[model samples]
Target: MSGLPPFAAPMPLDAAAPAALETTRKAPTSAWYALAVLIIATVLGSIDKVILTLLTEPIRQTLSLTDTQIGLLQGAGIVLFTGIATLPLGWLSDRYDRRVVLAACVVLWSAATAMRGTAMDYGVLFVASVGLGVGEAGLTPITNSMIPDLFPRAQRVLANAVFALSAIFGSALGALLGGTIVHLTDDLRPWLPVSMQQLEAWRLTFFVLAAAGIPVVLLVLSIRRTPRVGVPAAKPGAPAAVATGATTLRAHLREHWRTFAGLVIGVGLTSVGLSSLGTWLPIVTARTYGITPVQMGQGMGLAFLCGTVAGGLLGVGAMRYLQPRMGPAAALRLIMLCNFTAALLSTLLLFTRSANHNFMLLGLLVVPLIGSAVLLPNVLQDAAPAHLRARTIAMLTMASLPFGVVGPLVVGMLSDALKSVPNGLAVAIVATTLVGGALGAMVLRATEGPFVRLMRAAQPT
Candidate 1:
């Protein structure tokens, strides 16, 4: 409840006057430490979400579930509440101590993830999936909102890039580590009790992943609170305001409707393609090649790690190079092109009969996949006002869930129609990517003027 030290005094949310800003020689070691811990927490959350993808076949076979059901569990079932809840949760984050909101979410999701290990049927698993979504709803908004405060404006792109990498790492680790644990569980099955033996390796994998969250929660709690940067400092014992007006939200949207709507829908479309592919690629490769889940996990995990890293670094470089010659707007166009290219290449997976070729395409896909993910947020965050950052991001999160809900489910349904899961998923991914990328590009082009104006307003004279 105590106020930050004098040096850490909060500035008004609307402050644009240079005098109101804090001048620091550099962000303190504590800030960097906080960044490290946040990344670790994100990694844990991603593992919980991604392990489900690894276990799809196992869960489907065990529960007598269909691909549509698995997609629902992965997509809409999890995100329905996640999208709805984020508005309120995001408001809480903007108004309260983000550390508290973040810690609570970590504990909640971890518990929910652990519950997945105990699910007996469709109903139980559905509830657990819902719980997982509710818990995860708070993460992206809180984390992205905090990054700008933790680092300066100039460094936010780099910082956001670092944060985005955690998802990649977590996905990789979930496959690598989750697959390893599942393999181990198979070995240990003989020595286990009857109750445990009845449970599958997939179930035990969830348990292990859930247990991993404990340390992450401890890590979240261990981080000392830092003042929310660029906002007015509250009195030591006073509560921060929780309300933002509908009028304010409407007016902001009205002024920059193009940027707001375009980015949200554009990014949302992009998410459909990305999420569907991420959720289904492992299953596709496994089903197609008759490979073990463990091998697929290892292959995909290493590929993601290597590909995302290369993509991200190259993205930063591309931005710098293009911004100078083509201007920021044109540079953004280049980033979108890269995304479209990745999506276009993603279709090639279906044509290749060889696992090696598919894996190579997956790796190649990562370059543009990670590139677009990192830069798009940079553009969005730069355009949004400080006071509305969390809510704005939450809005995007809410909007994106529809894609999350439909993307995977549609792929599953399409696969069912085609009588081939692998081919159907590939067709679905390519279709979504092309549609999403084209729409995103159209909106970006239409809204460039509004986006530029907002970016200018965010700058100090």
Candidate 2:
């Protein structure tokens, strides 16, 4: 905030601009550091987000809540709060310190998550879930905006890939650890404040889960913030708006309207598929295959783990192999095309009649996991200018919050709506995912030319 620099006109295009066509950069050791912190924060951020989703079954029984009520809990409370909170937090990220915003977010969400255990009634718990959304929503924008600044334009794909794949990381960690937290909390009945004799272990799980976030907050506090890029070295001729007005949210939005709109649509749709699948996959595997949650966790968790790791590798490694041989646009276009196809197939396999079918389809899903993993973050960084990174991410967060917005509860609605076939929820998952994949993929294609030029303009003097 203190080191104010004057702005310059958008520089003329040159060979350096075309080089940005292949936005690959030399490797940085700092990237691994960024990835490690991003991964851990992502893991907890996800657990906090989906912890309620995982607890839906047990919470339903304890509160004597109907499926409709549960839907509101997941969809309305979680999504609405996130949508509202992201704006201010994102604005803060762009103007203030990103690490501070991220650290505060982890702390805030974690505390809210812990409070969820103490809810006496539906309204209290619902508000707490909203608080969780507010906190979690702040996360994506702050962190994402930081990635491009940390590495060169060339490395943004892999860097973004590591950042984006945090979804799979979040799901696997939430499901895998949510089970363990519930199982371990079984013995602590007396240590709790009330006789949770009738209450479910999942309540305790939420408390323990929130407690795990403290260290992540500490880790986030350690990272350094980057200065705004694209602002040129000052000539000190006539001065411009170097005071607060230059950094206001209104100014930023007006300047970056196109990028913001694209982000809204892109992140929103992508989130619907992500949230619905993540919030309910364990249940899907459970009812569809008649497998226990533990077994479902193991199988699905492994698939996510493989897809996540492979996606990370593809983010960094694939560009090096492809961009020169095939050209930047060709490399990205091919990946996006294939990734969309993979998403379509994954949806088909996911909704079909057989467990063998779902599993086999999921096997194929890993390949496209690379798509969501690699492309999303890369594209976002490409689209945004340096100062607007966090806020834009916040806007994306707001847009995407709608994905989970009505996502989880829709599953509950389907279950009760068609009483006999409880797992009929698969219909919604298939529908939303296909819709989201298509919309988000198209936006990616539309933005490529703009980003290629931006990247070329970014090479250091």
- The model with the greatest TM-score is 1
* Clash pairs for candidate 1: 11-231, 11-232, 12-232
What are the runs in model 2 whose C-alpha is more than 4 Å off?
1-35, 152-158, 187-199, 224-263, 270-274, 288-291, 313-339, 346-363, 400-406, 409-415, 420-423, 435-461
Error of 1 at 291 (Å): 1.7
TM-scores, one per candidate: 0.90, 0.76
lDDT for model 2 comes to 0.63
The alpha-carbon lDDT assigned to residue 312 of candidate 1 equals: 84
| C-alpha RMSD in Å of predicted model 1 compared with the true structure | 4.2
Residues forming the 10-long window of minimal summed lDDT in candidate 1: 1-10
